[model samples]
Target chain A: DAGITQSPRYKITETGRQVTLMCHQTWSHSYMFWYRQDLGHGLRLIYYSAAADITDKGEVPDGYVVSRSKTENFPLTLESATRSQTSVYFCASSENRLQETQYFGPGTRLLVL
Target chain B: LAKTTQPISMDSYEGQEVNITCSHNNIATNDYITWYQQFPSQGPRFIIQGYKTKVTNEVASLFIPADRKSSTLSLPRVSLSDTAVYYCLVAPPAGYGGSQGNLIFGKGTKLSVKP
Candidate 1:
């Protein structure tokens, strides 16, 4: 399958534990993004990477960390998870084209107790 | 960041044409409007994109008026399968290198298609 994928599609953790969500894409898209979808907030960008070793903050980057050591992978980590951080996280990739159409992975549903 | 406003939800029956409008009063000149369809428990899929005027693909049609402050997505002959949330996003010009551009996806319009 030549598409984006997220590992640990479903996750559960305690309030103070650390958690990491992995994202990988086969298309070698230069741009990768992480977004959290909550009930009323919709999709808020947490972080994004332009290429390997180049990451930037997004709309809601607090309490989250992201790294792109390789072009195909962008992993997001929660240093200390909180119940407020529980939401569906989506990873997307896109080329630097004029349209910049983003292709999203299935998603990772995180639940913090 | 250019903010977009769309309906909270809409309802339609099968074989009917449905149009969902989104308002982006702060759209920039170089920005582009894109629509994505998201089904429950899944990610969003790009449906269409347009700058101005009308753009149509096999899936749907996007109409951006001359002012570009708003856009409409038209789904023809919608079926039960077309029931999903549609997000209208205003994306800034593609950034180079490390510059981060905004693609704000607000609470999308949930279209409910029934028999």
Candidate 2:
């Protein structure tokens, strides 16, 4: 109900299908970020939003897209799901982009079948 | 952002104090060292942060030497529940086309506390 939350905690999709993972934060934080975590590695940033209507690419952002139309929302989209896209996606938010800790959501486990 | 190096894994006994060190030889003056703890199936949670010297909180302690090239995360009286991955990170100021919140999470130290 509060903090950051992600929708469809678990998702299943096939190749070539479009999928969207939703993230919401009640804190109205100024920054939101999307990350994907796969096996044998750490969390890699896919995209980040400094504020509403301002988003930037991170380490990995090829097949993923993100938008921040409102201060409390940032959603990630995959135009065409692929097996390699299957991973635990996490959404994070922070009051400001500088000198602050990023708070994370539980994560959305997507399985591309 | 400076590159960081840390142990791939560690083993410790329950009720023992555990310390995981990270090396960042190229750290900049504007960078701050931070640590995060993550359990399986969950996102990382911030443990402690330090600009230099040492910082402590209810969760853990962060020790940064004067050189700032290295830092250690100290976990006190660890228990089985403390077993998790610990990430060490450094971020430049937001002026460098990067926000402090835009952290780089490298392969963290997987700490296994045995009973």
Candidate 3:
């Protein structure tokens, strides 16, 4: 109840459909991030939010959109899902930048056909 | 932001000390070395962090030399449960914003502890 949570832990969506991955954190951390993990590439950051209403793109942001309306919620949206987008997505939060420890959600496994 | 390099994989017998070294040649003055351990299908959990010299915790120890160009994560008497991917990251100080300011992950060293 007090940690980060991701909704729809497992999802299967058709290509070209829109999908959204939800991330909620109870810690009220200022920094929130979304990362996608694949077998060969490891973990690649997709987006990060510094605070409410401030979000920036990370290493891999194409075809994805992120919005942070409140400190507790940062949602990632895929406008047109592709098969290449299939991966395990992780959401993490930290109180501030620097050496702060990041608490992560369980992760959302998405499969696109 | 500094890029780190580490071994791709390693294996060790159980109850043996395992040391995984990470090299960060361009580490900044304010950067801090941090390590995280991740089991399969789970997000990485913070192991230990250090700025210089040595820092030990209940889980593991972080060793940084005077040059600050590299750091080592030493897990004493590792067991099968300790088998996981260990990531070494160089994090910037607070309020540093940039594309690379975020935690940049490397391939990570996969340590398999066998009994």
Top candidate by TM-score: 1
In model 3, the clashing pairs are none
DockQ-wise, the better of 2 and 3 is 3
Better of 1 and 3 by DockQ: 1
Q: Summarize candidate 3's per-residue lDDT along B43-63 as a digit string, tens digits.
A: 888899899999999989999
* Per-structure clash totals for the candidates: 0, 0, 0
Q: How well is candidate 1 docked (DockQ)?
A: 0.62
lDDT by residue (tens digit), candidate 2, A1-113: 68899998999999999999999999989878898988777888788888898887777889988888999999999999999999999998878754468899999999999
> Model 3, A112: alpha-carbon shift in Å?
1.5
Candidate 1 lDDT over residue span A1-89, tens digit each: 89999999999999999999999999999989999999887888888888899888878899999999999999999999999999999
Q: What is the Cα-based lDDT of residue A107 in candidate 2?
A: 98
Give the per-residue lDDT of model 1 (tens digit) for B12-93. Answer: 9999999999999988889899999999999999999999999999989999999999999999999999999999888876
What fraction of the true interface does each of the listed models get right, in terms of native contacts kept? 0.58, 0.47, 0.55
lDDT of model 2 at residue A56? 79
Which numbered prediction scores highest in DockQ against the true structure?
1
lDDT of 2 by residue, B1-115 (tens): 5678889999999999999999988888888888888998888898888999989999788999999999999999999999999988786655324443346776799999999
* Candidate 3 off by > 4 Å: B96-101
Angstrom error at residue A64, model 2: 0.9
Determine which window of 10 residues in candidate 1 chain A has minimal summed lDDT: A93-102
